[model samples]
Target: MKEFNALVVDPVGLHARPATVAVNAASKFKSEIKLSYKGRSVNMKSIMGVMSLGIPTQSEITISAEGEDAEAAVQTIEEVLKTQKVIA
Candidate 1:
């Protein structure tokens, strides 16, 4: 498993637009991606799970992935977050 902490940088947080981008990026990985905040863990592929966290701008989030492509998954997701300007 690989883990990284990222802070939400998007002005609107993980609402509809960014959530869609996140989920799409997450879907490409074979690894099991998990996002956690405030002691709660949510499935990365589930939009509702992500939005339920209410990750506001500047809030820190932990992203972890496990499986064959865990490293790649983590890297890709990290890039996506950066590209979307979703993480700080």
Candidate 2:
């Protein structure tokens, strides 16, 4: 398993646009990826699940992946989040 933490930097937080980007990114991987916030965790590939968390600005989030491409999955998600300015 591989995991990394990030702080949401977007003023609007992880809204639909960023959440869609994240779900799209996670769907490309074969690994099981999860996003966690405020003690709740959801499948990163599911936009509904992610949005359900209602992650807000400055919130700490944990992304974790398990399986063959765990490391790559986590890295890709981290990059996507950063590029989208959803996290720093």
Report the number of the highest-TM-score candidate.
2
State every prediction's TM-score relative to the real structure: 0.92, 0.98
lDDT minimum window of 10 residues, candidate 1? 11-20
Flag regions of model 1 displaced more than 4 Å.
Answer: none
| Candidate 2: worst-modelled 10 consecutive residues by lDDT | 79-88
lDDT measured at residue 43 in model 2 versus the true structure, 0 to 100: 97
Q: For model 2, how does the per-residue alpha-carbon lDDT over 1-88 read when each residue is reduced to its tens digit?
A: 8999999999999999989988999999999999999899999999999999999999999999999999999999999999999997
Segments of candidate 2 deviating more than 4 angstroms: none
TM-score of 1: 0.92
